[model samples]
Target: MPPRPRTSRRTRRSARAYAILLPAVAATVALAGCASTVSLEHAEDAAAVECADVVVRLPDVVAEQAERQTDAQGTGAWGDPAAVLLRCGVPTPGPTEDRCVTVDGVDWVIDESDAPRYRFTTYGRTPAVEVVVDNEIVSGTTAITDLANAVSVIPADGACTTVTDPADVTP
Candidate 1:
């Protein structure tokens, strides 16, 4: 019988490398496709120049949640199930009874009516930015703080002031 040719050690190593690497590459591609696209609506001023700036400046992660792809412009999302969502260009909110908190130098009007799911809208910034956070998965404070730099690009025209402040009172 004719002798079979022996494979070289270098060839064997290359084959083994591919054997281990092929599956890893395939799994990564599969998992990436498995991530569903987040659906969102653009705000009234979504096309504003300031909104584009905010969207471009958004961080890759917020509150430990990795950012996700969104279906709309001037919008951002994070987490597998979307623990935090941001929309730039929402109508700038006016004085309200809702609780307001400042993170960094930016002020946010917090709506806690929904409890664990809270809506935070940037106050006093033109072409306002709005962020909705699922407090159960990530702290709203952390998410808002992470976003402060991006939202700050809009520039503040106003701020959250107490009704008791005499100078802030408007007739």
Candidate 2:
């Protein structure tokens, strides 16, 4: 009887490569099925009715990033890599030099110190909402606009002012 032919060296190497790659591919596929996980710090002041409303009203998609699963309440995140993250009930900020922009009706104080990653906080609302957006992944305005609808639920008590009013200045 003729002896069975031995597998070629190239064939053996190919098989080994495939064996090593198969698990990696499977792991990637499995992770793709699961939503991106976002770790968040829970806010102590987030128990307000307005915060709950904002959370419920948060958009499912922002700047084309689908909302992902977050581990904390009063928090919302978007994008597979979490390009945008929002947290409600943060302590209100006092006077600052940060640039402020109003969208829809909500006032946002923009902090670009980190560049590419921008942090926007509600100006005068109690338990102010804070949104951190990756400008590299999504435009800051777009993220703020998408979240504004939800954040507007919290009424603004005041707004950022660059100049102090003469009437308010004490002699």
Candidate 3:
């Protein structure tokens, strides 16, 4: 019988390394395909450490929608189509004519200019948190309520209030 050539140690090691790595790479790619990342723009103060605190505390599931991975810092998205999107470290909202509601001790200024999709921002918290919810997909109330605890990580410096004008009163 003819003698066969022996495989070199380096070639055998390379084959072994590939054999071990191929499956891992395939599995990782498969898993990555399963979970789609939601692209989002970072807030102005997204780099702030306080934003990290809020992001870490975000709920896994919000308004019956599961949380998805976001590309930006201090941002969170829930729902496959992303019915709810949250951005922390946004500019603090100034007093406006917009309606404000307090949920779970957190005051949120509601902007209804865009119907079916409302923008709710923390009323008094500096580096305010902004939550945009699509009413058709999920309840804005539920989304805001679910996010209250996490958003409350930033202490409230002020609160939503109604200014009474004396001129409106009839003598």
For TM-score, the strongest prediction is: 3
Worst 10 residues of 3 by lDDT: 162-171
**lDDT scores for all predictions?**
0.93, 0.91, 0.93
lDDT of 1 by residue, 50-99 (tens): 99999899999999999898999899999989999999989889989788
Enumerate clash totals for all models, in the order shown. Answer: 0, 0, 0
Scored by lDDT, model 1 comes in at: 0.93
Candidate 3 C-alpha lDDT tens digits along 21-131: 999999988987898899999999998888999998999999999999999999999998999999998999998888988999999999988989999999999889999
Residue-level lDDT of model 2, residues 82-159, one tens digit each, is 999999989899988778888888889999999989999999998899999999999989999999889998888998
TM-score for each prediction?
0.78, 0.75, 0.81
**Prediction RMSDs, each to the true structure:** 4.9, 10.6, 5.2
Estimate the TM-score for candidate 3.
0.81
What is the Å distance of residue 136 in model 2 from its true position? 0.5
| Weakest 10 consecutive residues of candidate 2 by summed lDDT | 28-37
lDDT of 3 at 73: 93
